[model samples]
Every structure is written in C-alpha cells, then in structure tokens.
Target: MRDSIRLRTRARLAYTACRRTRCSRGSLRELSAVAVLITALSSACENPLAPELCGAVADQVVPAGGAVSVRVCFNDENGDGVSLASRTSDGTVATVTVRGRVVTVTGVRGGTATVTVTARDPGGLSATVSFGVIVPGIVRLTDRHGLMPAWSPDGTRIAFLGRVPETGDTGDGSIFVMNADGSGVKRLTKSISAVAPPAWSPDGTRIVFTTRDFEIYVVNADGSGEANLTNNADWDVYPAWSPDGTRIAFVSDRDDDIEIYVMNADGSGTTNLSNSHGRDDWPAWSPDGSRITFTSRRGDDIDIYVMNADGSGVTNLTNNPALDLWPAWSPDGGRIAFRSGIPFSADIQVINADGSGATNVTNNPEYVYGSVPRWSPDGTRIAFTSADRNNTEIHVVNADGSGEATLTSTAGTVFGDHAWSPDGRTIAFSSNHSSSGFHVYVVDVSFFGKAAKRATR
Candidate 1:
C-alpha cells in the first residue's frame, strides 16, 4: 500500500513537473491537486517502493588531531516517516551522531571516517532510506582480482601481486606492494615466468612468494634482500609462516612428489611433515603454533590431513575423494578452509579441526573454480579467488557460505593465490591491473567505505 502511494505520488509529481506551465513553480492549489490524485491512484493499485524520508551524515573531515562536524542531509524523497538512526561502518559511532538532518562528529583522528544514516518508517518497524559519509586522505586498496591478502602486522603496509595491461604488462603476472591507503605503489618483484601466491610472516617484516618453478623465495618488503628459500630447483611453493615467526611450511617435490615441508625462518632445518608415500601439500599452522593441517593424496583422494609441528604423527582429516587442497586454519584454531574439485570446477570447503563434518560452504555452482581460501582474523568471513565463465574475481562469503559477493571484476586477468590481512579489512592479490609489471595490489576491506576517501588523496 505504501509503495503504491509513493509511486502514484511520483507519477503525479513528474506529470505536473513536465506539464506545460508559464510559471516554473506550481501554486499550493496545484500541488494539493497532484497530491490528492496521487493518493487516490495509489489507493487503487498495488505496488512496492514506498516513498521513504531519511537523513544521513553526508560529509566528514578530520585532521590529525582535530574534531570535525559531520553534515547530515535530510532526504525528503518519497516522504514516509522521519525516525532517523545512524551507524558507523566499522560499528564505532562515537565519531558521529545524527538527529533529523544534522550530524555532529567528535574525537576523530585526522584522516577519513565513515558514518551511515538510515531512516525508519513512521511505524518504526522497517528501514526506509539509507546513505553514506565520506572524507578524504584515507586510502583503500582494492583489485580486480585480489585475494589471500597478507598485511604486515605493523598495520602500516600491504603486499600482494597484480597485473595491469594499460601499464603494458600481461594480465597474467606480477608482484606489488603499496601503503595501506593504496599509495606509494612500489612494484617489489617482476617476472615473465608468472608469479603468484604471496604470504607474509607473523612479524609484519618479510614476504615469501612463489614463481612458475614452484619454488619459494623470501624478499624484504622494501624490495631488497631477495633469497630463494627453496633453492633446490625442485617444484616447491606455497610458503606459509609459523605463528612464532620461526618457520615456513611449504610444498616441495624433493621427495619425488609434492609434499609439505617446514624450514627454519632462514631456509634451514627443512623436513617433510606429510611423510606419506603419496603427495601432500598446503600446510597451515594452528594459531598456537602446535599442529599443522594440510591436504594430502594418501587416501586415494585429495583430502585434509593434520600432524604435529615437527613433521610427525601425520593424520588424514578429510578422508574423502573430492580432491581437497589449500587448507587454511581459522585464527582461533577451530576450523579449516580448503579448495576442492576437478581443476577448474573447485569451490571453497570448510571443516572442523577434528575433521568431524566437512561442508562445502561455498556451494555456488557459479564459482566454477574457487581456490586460495583465507579467513579473516575475526572469523566472520572467508575470502578466496574464484573464476566464472567470463572472468575471474576475488570473492568473499560468510563463514556459513552465505552472502557470496564478488570484489574484483573483468578489468584484467586475476590469477594466482592471495593473502588476507590479519586485521581482515584488506586483500592482497596478483592481477594484471597495470600490465606494465606484475605488482602486488591491496584492496580495502573496511566496511566503512574507507577506500574512496584514500583514492581522492
């Protein structure tokens, strides 16, 4: 009923606005007639999109230490009710408050803050309108194909890989790093051999990555001190750091097949954890630095396996024929996420640490191939790389596999694995965004609309 009334009102207003009139402004009598006609027409029809009146903080500006007054605009569109409610995208609302069309912000650090406004209907039962607040200098990192983004623990920077063709590089490979706001874009590593799968250490200090040879190499975040951790010339790759910053678990073919191995932080003490005769790879450590879980081909199928820290007591967890690989543990050490399938027909799957009930959380058939699953620090969502029939993009889904959405587009080819920041607000992945070189890219994962503000600066 409300929608009908709103639509009729809009139609009548549009008709009056477009009707021939000597004077541009309509008189009170004409307005009243239009309103009456709209009300009558609405009462006689069924519709949706009830006109709603809402207000939101549209502007926010803060400097390093000063407070900024926020501006809230009164949205009279479709005029339904006036109950106003607002929230910060990060759920921290002390920076701004809303009442009617006015909003005041206090105690904001010089940068950008986002506050959202929503209006409830007269009945106070449903939200009628919504909008956003934006400021400048707050940079955000995003990509057409960013996934598995790993942030340096210091929170000052991010490193991922991407490809940008307009920059004259192939959409197929590159490695890059930039400030948290998407500035200071320094391409750290470049190669025509197809570089992908980058991971950072727990100390926010060093980075380990993989190239076409499946060998892992460590490089200083500043693009110096590059060293190949797996210099054996075997197919060894997918390096993940231990929680204590003392070891890196990666895959290697030194055993005549792909297997998970651990080494000292400095590329020493290399030992195979999944000593099974079959292939095993993708080792991720538990949060406490105790056990490691990975995928193995020992059970005549690709499945998840867990073992102790010292490459002992290897145990198969998944026990299925679905071909599960790329197992990532939740930050809390409760569950694990992995990718499974027939090459391009893979999806993100999750299971408990004990392997008591595996579920394919991302059950979407649309994701013909989904790989490289990483969980946010808060354990609320999982981000992974996915490809459809037309293009490849980084996608996120809730822990329960609901609310699946794409973060990147067909702007370029998005290949390789990605790492998620420990803070869970950004992703670093490799894409051909610039095309000049395969550089790592960062995308803001902040719910507060922080990326746009950073870009304008």
Candidate 2:
C-alpha cells in the first residue's frame, strides 16, 4: 500500500508541474483522473525543497526618520535550512535591512516605497513577498521663544516676534527673521516694542506688525527700512495684508469703538469696513483680496463677520451663541476656520465662507482651549494650539475634522500662534518648551503619520 501511495504522489506532482507549465489539454484531462486519487497521498509526502513564507505581506506606512520591523516566518518543505533577504524598491524613499527572519525598514523621505523580502532554500526554491513602506513624522526646527511665526511669501523664510531675554525694560520683544528651518535667525527690528505677530507683504520685501502702543509698523526683510505704518493714537492692531499687496486691513478704535479698517499698502486710504456698534477685531484678508474676515461682538455673542474689501456687504459668517473668534480664511476662500466654546475651553470649528456647514473639529473632552487655527496653504489641514490637563501643545487636524495629531509633547509648556509655510511642508509656531519664555519653532507637518505621537521636545 505504501509503495502504491508513493507512486500516486509522484504522478500527482508531475501532473501539477505539467499544468503549471501549460502542457497540452489532452495531458491535463488524462491527469485529472489520477489527481483526485493521489491528492491526499501528495499532501502526506509534499516536496521539502519548496519554501513557504508566513505572516503579513501587506504594505506598511512609516514616518520619515522612523523605523518599523516586520517579522516573517520562513520554512522549507524538506526541513532544509532557509535564508531571508530584504531590499527596498527605492533607496531614497526608505532603507531595508535583514536580520534573520526579521526585516527592518527605515524611511528616508516623505514618499511611497516598497520593500521586498525573499525566503530561499538550498534546493533552489525561493519565495518573495512585497509590501509598501511610508514614512511621515515631525521635525523640530527651533528651540527658542519663536512666537507667532509667519512664513514669507516665497516660502523660504519665517518672520516672528522674538522675546529678547531680559533687556532690562518692560518691552524686550523684537521682530525677527529666520530661515524656514529655524536657521539664520536675525533680529530685524532693534529697540522697538513689537507686541503682535508680523504679517508678510505680498512681495516678500516688507513685514507689517503691531506694537504695544497701538501702532502699525512695517520693516524691510533685512531690517533696513523700519517705518510705522499707523502712527495713530487709538490702538491700531491686527494688521492683515491683502493678497494683491494693495491694502492692509486692521482693527482700531479711532472711530470711538473698535472696528475693522482698511489702509493702503503704505498705510493710506484708511477706511472703516465694519463700522458696527459692536467691537470688531482680528481682521484677516481673503486670498483673492476681495473680502476681509474679522471677529465681532455685534450681538450678545462674539461671532465672525465678513465684508467686501471696500468695507461693504458685511455678513456674519458665524452667528452662534458661542464665542467664535480668531477667524482665519482658507487659501481657497471656500471656508473659514476659527475657535469656539467658552474662553480657555474652546475647540476648533470651521464654517463655510457663506456662513454654513459649521463643524467642531477637535472635540476633546479635556480640551481647555484652542487658538489660531491656521490653514495650510494647500487647504487640506488646519494647525492650532490646544491645552488639556497637562499642557498646551501644538495640534493639527484634517479640514474635514479627522486625523487629529499632537505635534509637541513638552509637559507644562505652552505652544501657540502657529503659521504654515507656503509649501505646506512645515509649521512655524511659538512655544516655551525649552525655557521659561516662548520661542519660535518650525516642525515638519508631513511627519504626522503613525509615528507622530512620539514626543518631540
């Protein structure tokens, strides 16, 4: 009986090999009769030279600069020794290394790559499994108090308010410029009391900022031409430059009550856009220079309002009972993102440009407050600051209220006033994670993949 089974097993193996090699259909039909009779016999005496691989062969997503390990089980049917090797499809996207049965992959950049692991036996039988590797994570840029960073129009440099450590006076802050990677940090304005974040001109040559004395100032990118755009005495602040570089919209109480005003690029042609009885501040210009958005208190609640560039057709974009402030226009001008809920306990909310489709993005129960929801230039993600029970950290969420990620993880530190680089590759923000005072920081936004939760100090 054993001899008969052995013969049947050999015949079945030969038939399978013939079919795999696309033999004639007549031979296949002839083998079909024997295939059923020898199937169990072949299974009992399978070839040992053939190699088999076990474990997941699905693609993996990894953050840039992060590593992931995949363990595969390899075995030979004949009980012979098996070896494994690993390789990457693109070395620039990721690197792969083999150690026994484990394959380690390291991401080198922010793109898709494939990894192939092969198991081979001494009998010349080999099996290969291919999977994808993706790398995404955050890169810390600065270590100092770099508050309210604004990217240049060219997306190469960043301008922010740097707190001069202990200038021996009440006002120690100055307007500073640095490369987008947090290098070449240069103080652009010396001996001036800069109180607000600087806004870059459309041409990238000038920066407009506000002072503690309620005045608007503009300085050259190299700190050469420092001029006060608004020398008024009625607290002019929150200057926003139009997309065309033709006008700047700011808030001032020069009209007895705080209201939205627009001035030319050189601080001329000042006109009140929202001359409401309520206080309106925090003016932000639309990307097309056709509209301006600001926060107002026209009713019992603080809401977001929008108006034409020429200070007409004022419309309330967010008229909820909850205070909606810090209105930021998306790059496409289709939606507006802002902060809602009570003070110090707010969430990031987005609304349509026409005052519709309001959604709460960061619905964290422990959230104390969130601030400055800046949209990426691509208009896909929104970066902001949120504080929980522990500390205030930088966070980012998708435009449709998904993929909430915490970017910073310094206990007890406050990170706020974030600005996205024009390419949407990095986020520049203000944080005191390194010391007692807030400093500027730039973190790669693309690295918010699976490895983003790893604390970046």
Candidate 3:
C-alpha cells in the first residue's frame, strides 16, 4: 500500500541539484512551500542495493488541531517488503502515528515538532528519513473581512477594521478589538463606510481611525467615549501614534494639499508637520519617538523623508527617482527599510537613518513587494508580501536580505496590514488564501528559515 502512495510536495515542486536533471523557479502564483503533501498511486525510485527510504518530508503550517499525512516506504529491488515505524521528536507540538505505511501527523498546539520515520526489512536492515513539522505559532483570528490589525500597547488585544456584512469589496468597516488569542472579540466603532486602518493608543485605552467622509475619530477600547478628533470638512487619514504616546501623526488635505499633520492625544493642538505642496503621507515614528519618517513626492519624485518630532530637520533619505514608499524604522532606530522600483513593490531596500548608505536587500524583480517592509521586533528581519507570479505571499528575510523564507505560499493572495506580536514570535496579517473573504490570520514566526526545505524551494 505504501508503494502505491505517490509523493507530492505542496502545491508545486521545486527541486534543487539533488538528483535533478532540470530545476527552474516555480511560478509565482501557484507555488507553496508549506509541506511535503501525500497523494496516491505511484511508485518511488527503485534501489537495487538495499531497502532505501524514498521521498522527502518538509515543514508544514497546520492549525492547533489540524492534521497532515505523509506516505513512507522503502524501495527494495529485492522482493522482501519492509515494515514502517514513525516517531515524533516533540509530541507537544504534533503527534505521529503510522498505519500500513501512511504516517499521519496531528498538530497539538502552537509549536514545532520533527517526525522521523524508519523502514526495516526482514533482514534487520533499515533506512530512516526525517522531516520537520511546524504547527505554526499561527492562528486565523477572523473568519470575515478584517484589515489593518494594530496591537495594543500591552499586547493583550488587537484593534482592526471589521467589514460591514452588507458592504462587499468596498474596503469599509467598523473598528473592533479582540484578545491576542483571537477570543473576546468586541466592536468599538460604527463607521459603516470606508474606515481606514485603526491605531491603538500607547496606554491601550483608546483607538483612532479615519472615515471615508473625511473625519478622524477616537474612541475608548470598549466602544465608549467616542470623539471626533478632526471634525473637519477636509480629508484626514493615515494616523500613527508617537512612540512616547504624547501625539498622533496623520495626513490631511485641509491645507488644500496632502501633508503630514500631528495632534495631541486629545482633539487639541493640531499641528502641520510637513507643509509641502507635494504629496506627503505614510508617517512612521522612530523607535525613540524623536523623529518621523514618511514618503513624499516633494522633488518631482517619490522618496522617503525623515523629520524631527516637531517637524524640523526634514531630510530626504532615498532621494531616488523611482517611487520610494513606506519607510519603516528598525526597532533599534538605526536604519530604515522601504520599497523601491515601483509602488507594486519592486524591491525592498534599506538605508541608514542618517541617509548615508542605501542597499537593496531583495534584488529579485520577481519577488514584488506586496506592501511596506515590516521589521521584526528585534530589528533582525523584515517581512513583506511577494507576488512572485502575481500570487500574494508573506515572506521573511534577514535584515541583510539573506535567508529569505516563504511563510505563506498559498494559491490565493495574502493582503497587507501585517503586525508582529509584542514578543515577536508571531505575525498577524490578512489573506484570502482559505477560499474565503479576506480575514485576519496570525503565523508564529518560529518557522523563520528553520523549517523544512521544500522540493520546490
């Protein structure tokens, strides 16, 4: 029965130099490096010398109770068959059991485990192969449309935009919050049309978001004490909290042009930070809260810029002719990561905070940046979406752009708005990968580059 079970790895196969007479990169949209999936009805390669364990096992991202099975067998040119035995290195994350040559692995929790399978012939000769299974520190928090997830300062709750059931594909929703474990979901705001991403206050008591009709609102985390901060007729959106929690930075067209603006925690002391005629948006606060980084088209080209908290000492960091967008500061406040080449995310590049050295980390044109580059909590790695073949996937890379690993290579698209857990062990993002509406999901980053390699890698 084991000999008849065919070996399949994920949605597509990418084989390197091992026994491969041909190796080409997998197509962007259809490839996933998630697991060494099992199929039926094919024989593995024959081994004339001894019982050779055939096929390979790769890493997997399964939910807490999910299960994946792999077929194990030995190629015995000699007619003697073999018996199979399988064991898990860590039973806490996953459990393995073998029945007739099929090894079924069940995920226990949010962790990782390695499974090793041994095939022994009657002569006492045996062969063994092992594969790693990552019961991903991952969870799909929302079953419906939930976008722009923001972690509360205390990391206990996540604030996001929940789509109104009646509105489809309009990118509008009411603000909501849920516990970090995805339970205790509660609605906070009632903005039914075109609600921008929500931002949490530093003290974790309140949230801020913008509406499609050009207004900004702040409300308590429990859905009380709602106030219109920017009760204006002009546009106001893209609000960001300062590191010190004293101020909020946002973009407004009240000046008759789009520019960066800042306001106090309350609805007072509104200040215009970037008073440029060119478009300036996507403000980000440095780790120390001393400066702000944003992207602008001030010089007839889109580039990243940094300025003091008070809107002084403005300097252009990228200065490139290409459209540079989404400037993200490292956790240590030493460097910045942004997308260069095209708005569709051509490449992810990093530059020193002082605007001295700029380097391209992901130079491949195929790995289109899905959104802004997000830095890990330790500032050691960056996560972004890749449209390798126009399939939106979440990927992680070393700060230096090394050790790139494909985390979610689903057949569907992984939308943006990814947020890291405060402890940095998990990342929450939005995706339509499960053949459902866009929902919020989280993946434990424990699988970062350490997971099993895919034959299609």
Model 3 Cα shift for residue 109 (angstroms): 11
Global CA lDDT of candidate 2, please?
A: 0.78
Off-target runs (Cα >4 Å) in candidate 2 are: 1-144, 165-171, 447-457
Residue-wise lDDT of candidate 2 within 235-318, one digit each (tens)?
898888888888888889998999988889888888988988999988888888888888999768899988888888999877
lDDT of 1: 0.65
Q: In angstroms, what RMSD does candidate 1 have relative to the true structure?
A: 13.9
Model 3 residue pairs with clashes: 14-455, 14-456, 28-388, 28-389, 137-444, 345-369
lDDT of 3 by residue, 1-457 (tens): 4443323432234433321544345533223332232231122223334577666665655545556777776786555688889888889888999998898988777776778888777767777887777766557898667887888877788888887554344434788899987899887765445367788887888888887787888889999998888888999998888977788999999989899999998879999999988999999999899999999988579999999999999998878788898999999999999988875548888999998788888877766785889998888999887786656777788998776665664567777578887878788887776766777888878666553643310
How close to the true structure is residue 40 of candidate 1, measured as C-alpha lDDT? 62
Lowest summed lDDT window (length 10), candidate 1: 448-457
TM-score of each: 0.61, 0.68, 0.70
> Which 10-residue window of candidate 2 scores lowest in summed lDDT?
448-457
Task: Report the number of the highest-TM-score candidate.
Answer: 3
On TM-score, the stronger of 1 and 2 is 2
How high is the lDDT of residue 56 in model 1? 28
The runs of at least 3 residues in candidate 3 whose Cα sits more than 4 Å from the true structure, single-residue gaps closed, are 1-137, 164-172, 191-194, 447-457
